[model samples]
Target chain A: MSCEKQSPPELPGCQEANGPLDFQLRILSDPRLLAVVRCTVAEFAAVSGFKEDQCRSITLAVDEALSNIIRHAYNNRRDQEIEMRLHADIGCLEFTFVDRGEPLDRSKYCAQPLDAVALGGRGTHLIRQIMDEVVYERVSEGNRLRLKKYLPPARLTP
Target chain B: MTHLLDDKRDATPMKISTRELNGTTIVDVTGEIDMSTSPGFRTALLESLKKTPRLAVNLTNVRYVDSSGIASLVEVLKAARISDKRLVLFGLNEPVQEVLQLTRLTKIFEIRKTEKEALEV
Candidate 1:
């Protein structure tokens, strides 16, 4: 099993205390699945104590991640298995995407400049903006992409 | 190991409702616009372009949009500019606004806070 873990601050509902509040999803590499997964991510963020706007940003970030995986990693090969794991705690929310497809070239990753009028390549840029930490690793038969978003301190205040 | 939602893939079809006001075509879209749905959006937008030179895309009801959706809008915007037409977008929720901001596209498009202002632009 491929796993990419986020280093979370000691907070309530962490894995050691509340098992990290996780859900595993296995969906075919299909664009039709993006909406459902986005909805699920929104719910996850909302329940994880994120504000409404934050929840929307988080959902878009994860959706872009999955879209990149389907388009780049799997090369748009439908029906291929893609595994996703969502973990949340009081401190942060993390998403891990595992795919048994092509390894991404790290050197060529660049988000287009904002002033430039273009499209179809803004995923990485959006992900970096929405998430606090992003890590990618190549495994034996697949690749792992991990995204983490730290909860706002104001939201955590009781 | 476990699937959360049921297999309801074919449930919601993206709907684009268009109307004419003040010689501008207003396109109100609702539903997710990712790879599966951008084609329809592109077709609708292209058809709408044939009708009027000024277009306003109302995304107030749209909950989600991926890069492909953005690509469709960009294509239409380029076409509109080449033909000396005007395109305006308004009522962008936080998520939609964030996506545009992150991609540095906020400056490239004419964005308004409400339909009234979008029409005025």
Candidate 2:
């Protein structure tokens, strides 16, 4: 079976946490999904310990990674459903994108940014610089890319 | 993965506000930049280049940029290289700076961290 045809391992936080303190988002590859995901992150920020900068990192990373899939993985073809899941938990958040398509060229991508300023190649680069940790995997039917970013360790205050 | 945002407007997110400072037209951009929006960005920046030898772009309000944003900037760079005019970036946000660093583009163009610095360079 293609990796996409298989289900993802149950995510770490989504299956464990509950409350106004947490969030989980799952949406198909539609570009409009950014709104719902951002709103969820906003909610996590408002009620939990995260600040805006931390949230924006996740948002932008997700945006870039997904944009890459939209542009290259699926090649701007809308027929594929880009699935994303965000889990905000204890000290950080984890975001995942799953799509059943061809594997990407790892060599073609570097988290490092370049200034040749070509129009089409910026997507993968953006995802690496902004997010704390990025991992790419190929499961049975599809490709999985996950990003994780940590909030500052909680401060000890008076 | 399908990362396309489903905003109804389909209008480009980048906005243009131009000011003539020291005889150069400085175009300030504010908003999210992407494929849907970068073409407009390219259009606006290129238009500014036509009328002046010096163009300063203030990117302070630009919240996010993607390949398209870089492309638009590159477009300006190409124009500057060919025209022998100067195009500079001012008020680069962290995300923008991060993009430049990864691309190693800082060496190619004059970048100022603030509007004042950009104007001076």
lDDT (Cα, tens digit) per residue for candidate 1, span A1-158: 10111222356755464346899999999988887787788777766777667777888889889888888898999889899999987678999999998999676575456456675677787788889999999988699999999987876663
The lDDT per prediction is 0.80, 0.67
By DockQ, the best candidate is 1
User: For model 1, what is the alpha-carbon lDDT of residue A155?
Assistant: 67
Runs with alpha carbons beyond 4 Å of true place in candidate 2: A1-36, A42-48, A111-122, A154-158, B1-12, B17-22, B93-108, B112-121
**Total residue pair clashes for candidate 1:** 1
Model 1 residue A101 CA deviation in Å: 1.3
Looking at model 2, residue A69 earns an lDDT score of 75
Per-residue lDDT of model 2, residues A1-158, tens digit only: 11111112344768533331333444555554544455455444433445445445556567678777766677776668776666656555677788887788777776334545565566666677767898999888688898877656652110
After superposing candidate 1, which stretches have Cα over 4 Å from the reference? A1-19, B1-10
Number of clashes recorded per candidate = 1, 22
Best by lDDT: 1
Query: Which docking category, incorrect, acceptable, medium or high, applies to candidate 1?
Result: acceptable
Residue A29 in candidate 2 has what lDDT? 58
lDDT of 1 at B95: 60
Pairs that collide, model 1: A114-B104
